[model samples]
Target: MINSIIKLAFGIEYDGTHYCGWQRQREANSVQEELERAIAKVANHVIDVVCAGRTDAGVHAIGQVIHFETKSERKDISWIRGVNSYLPADIVVRWVKVMPNAFHARFSAVSRSYRYIIYNHPYHRPAIFSSGMTYYDDFLDIDKMQRSAKCLLGENDFTSFRSSQCQSKSPKRYMMDLTVTRHGLYVIIDIQANSFVHRMVRNIVGSLIEVGCGHQPENWIGNILLRKDRQLAAGTAYAQGLYLMLVRYPLHYEVPQSSIEDFFLIPLLS
Candidate 1:
């Protein structure tokens, strides 16, 4: 008798506050390391997972996706509950599904979405969920931020917004949508792209904040993009403010979509 290998995909969520990052590291704890260990315990063999996006340290993910191959057989419910039993509270396997071997967690993804939450009050700090959002004491001009964000829509070479350490072969990316909205004291920056270079979203947010704070004009964002100079852009924003919101795959794959309401307090955008 021969055992057949099976492929499974998982929807994962993690606080990402304590772990170093998603990838396994030699010296520190990582989200991938913890997850693999937990799944290994349940599978009775070593397991490796490939995530749709490898989020940096301190960045949270509510819609993370991953896939792995295994020879063991188990029901979807058993995979979820059994894996969670050995994992830390911060990391969780929210859903599981058996997938065709052709499906890939990262390569099959069509688009990735990210949300950055900012507390824009001057005096008081957010006592609740402080670790999940970034606080800026200075008042931000939401109108200015929104105007600057418009230039980011469509495909462009995002060299100005990419990190020096980025390993991507090209600086080009398709910006499907970019929006800045305000809900009470909270300001939200939502972005969707075909793919991103390292720290691209945070870097763009940093430059936009400069515009919102009056340090730079709204036109500055467009100028920065045209210049293609990293030094002309503002510093990268805090990782805590960032959240991996969604990953979309082709309809044939039947990958589940995640809801923003699961991790946010703001009203859903129309």
Candidate 2:
């Protein structure tokens, strides 16, 4: 008897510029559509994919995780190449592996980390039509931005920083960590949370930019949280600069990559 279910984890990357996002929509291009189509051709059957999180249009992911089940037995690792052959160059499956039957990619996630990159030089704006990153040429005070970001570290009603279009019933979220770092002209903002609401990260970045620009007092973030008003927040940061970096799960669900050691050549002479 052919096995009924084969659990697999897939690492995927995509240039979301032309797509409407990761989810399906009417006449809208999406990463999910491309992936499902590729899988159907290879497995010769319809398959449903479950992802750790949804990425908005123009966003990017260096380590996005997803899982799916198929009734057919996978023959070998060449499945990656076979799938890639049909998928667009912008969308590629890095690899796939059999996971425990009980492992779930979405619900089992413990945390998610996102990295936002911005170019802060007047002449260093992101490339034209570059939909995967944002460019802000004005000078920003990184130290002030970091200080303002600290007000978001604890659990709070993020209504102020969320999009008005958000459909989530509640706006409360616990921010695990938020850091702003500067490297030459690039300002990197890293955020970790148990979960995030729609537009939360972008809005937070927008608010921080306002503080960094001295348009708002340093205590602005705290005031917004206390105010709990969406109108109090600044415009959403450009979607292109955000990336879903990593998804964390319980220790038992930890993924192991044997070849990672080989990828980093340790000195044999040492």
Candidate 3:
């Protein structure tokens, strides 16, 4: 097959609060649309990009991967500055580069890391604003949260945390690790897995929070996993506080960046 496609991969970051999600949509604001507009201005032509993952509305990403095809052969093109200048303050192109045509941004990825943030407080919420902040009075016991998250390793069916909108054909996946830590009033839960259902991470976080709050037994986490039913899981957390932290690809196909900034550096609550 003869192809004239120039595959350009980019690292992106966005607040996601002001947009619908990563996918393109009609009438609704989306990160995809905003990104395409900025990139078009930079490349001086039409370009459509596909992301490794499509986060929900109000979600955020510090380091997300996307790929697009263009015929322009200018490797020296100034897309970084040009695209950022046109993009709204909430979204940005951190880095961009040419990639092998065989690399699929989503499918080529090996794993993804995600995080959930909780404002645990007794009398107030948690102080987490760059401006005047409310709901700033809670505490999360990190040690307890960590202890409660230990049941989530190895391969298993994650039906308890799956979302109704999830399109995956199966609920089986591997969880590499899970960590619960606290920085001030922020309760951060980090989890890495081969893949995740739409609300799996959030639902797991909710259950962990419940365990920390003494609502459920420590062993209840295992029971939920064994239940294998979405309805039996804890409530899915809000999208506003979740983040698509990282996407790992083979080292050979990795994009070379001076400073490879990604979602791992992002604060859980931000």
Best by lDDT: 1
Residue 131, candidate 1: C-alpha displacement in angstroms: 0.8
lDDT of 1 by residue, 118-168 (tens): 998999878988989999988999899999888889999999999899999
Candidates 2 and 3 compared: the better one by TM-score is 2
Per-residue alpha-carbon lDDT of candidate 2 for residues 31-88, written as tens digits (9 for 90 to 100): 9989989987888899789888888998887667889888777654767887889999
Q: Please give the CA lDDT of all the candidate structures.
A: 0.92, 0.81, 0.76
Q: Residue 79 in candidate 3 has what lDDT?
A: 74
Please give the distance, in angstroms, between residue 54's alpha carbon in candidate 3 and its true position after superposition.
0.8
Stretches of candidate 2 off by over 4 Å are 256-270
- Name the lDDT of candidate 1: 0.92
Q: What is the RMSD of candidate 1?
A: 1.5
Model 2 earns a TM-score of 0.91
What pairs collide in candidate 3? 120-138, 120-139, 121-138, 121-139, 124-137, 125-135, 126-135
> At residue 110, what lDDT does model 1 achieve?
94
Give the alpha carbon lDDT tens digit for every residue of 1-270 in model 3: 454868889888888877888888999999999999988887778988899888887788866899998866554347787788999999988778788989988998888887666655667653454211112233555677687677788898888888888899999989998988766656667888888877788789877777777777788788899988877767876777677777888899966433222334344334
| TM-score: model 1 vs. ground truth | 0.97
